[model samples]
Target: MAALLEYLPLILFFAVYKFVDIYWATGVLIVTSSIQLGYHHFAHGKIATRHWIFFAIALVLGGLTILFQDEQFIKWKATVIYAVLAVSLIISRYIFKKNLVEKALIGVLKSANEKGDTDAPLNIELPKHICEQLNLMWVAILAFIAGLNIYIAYNFSLDFWVNFKVFGLMGITFVAILITMAKIYKYLPEDQS
Candidate 1:
């Protein structure tokens, strides 16, 4: 159910585009994106920066698409969002010297004992080098996705581009997640795995 909700906006946008048109699809995308963010805030208590960024880009670009009656604006949203994310990750790593991937995975710190010094429960401690590598991998994937989106949006037909946005991009993200999991599998404690 959570997974479905996570993707509800994209799924709805695709379905609406099939039934109506790009304009309607863009409107639905904005509304559904907002709903998704609200759902996240309600369920998780706070919205993540990436989620906020995604919604802001969707709203601005989608609004322009609707107001100007140009699907091109909406089409560019995906590319811009992906590019911004990739750049953000690169800056976070290179400029800030913070590995966002590592920061994301190291959820709430908990001392497993009375000493308040042990972190045994979260045994999945990935090495710093591994985290840096994973961060680089994510940045590379985002950059590739961003470039591909622009290429398809320009070269392909409208319907094909919409389909690519809804399915192709989502499929890429799923595959990336799977690959990342496989990459990190060796880092997990044997007893937990």
Candidate 2:
């Protein structure tokens, strides 16, 4: 359900593209992304930084595509966004001495503990090596996605690119997420007997 909500804008964009045209789809995407961001902000009292970044990119790129009457801007939106994220993750991990993946996981565990959802007190500290590796993995994933989007945009038809953006990218991301979770499972604290 949460995942579906996360993809709502892209799904709507694909539907609008099929029903009408790229311009209309771009317009719908902008509106839907704004709404999604607003909903998250209102419901959670804060929005994820990544969601905010994506929303800004959607508005700017979608606006450019609509205003200039060129789909290329919108096509390059994913690549630019993903590249920015990849760079940011790398900088955070290396320059800032922060591991976003580990921080995010620890944040979730902290929230769960605050909500009394855990059977035992959760340890927020992760092994330094694990954090470094997780951050690198995320950076690699984002870079790969950025390259994949650009490759598809340049090589495929607009319709095919749209389908790949909405479905293929999501599928690949889901699998990557599963793999990441599996890789990190061994690092999780053991259940208290």
Those runs of model 1 whose alpha carbons end farther than 4 Å from true positions after fitting are 108-120
Note the Cα lDDT for every prediction shown: 0.84, 0.86
As a whole number from 0 to 100, the lDDT of residue 43 in candidate 2 is 85
- The runs of at least 3 residues in candidate 2 whose Cα sits more than 4 Å from the true structure, single-residue gaps closed, are 110-117, 191-193
The candidate scoring highest on TM-score is 2
- Residue-level lDDT of model 1, residues 1-193, one tens digit each, is 8779878888898999999998999899999989988988998899988888889999999999999999999989989988998898899888998888777755422222323444456656788887888898899999999999999999999999988998899899989888877877787666434
Give the range of the ten consecutive residues with the poorest summed lDDT in model 1: 107-116
Give the top-scoring candidate (lDDT).
Answer: 2
lDDT per residue (tens digit) for residues 128-167 in model 2: 8877777888889889999999999999999999999988
lDDT of 1 at 7: 83
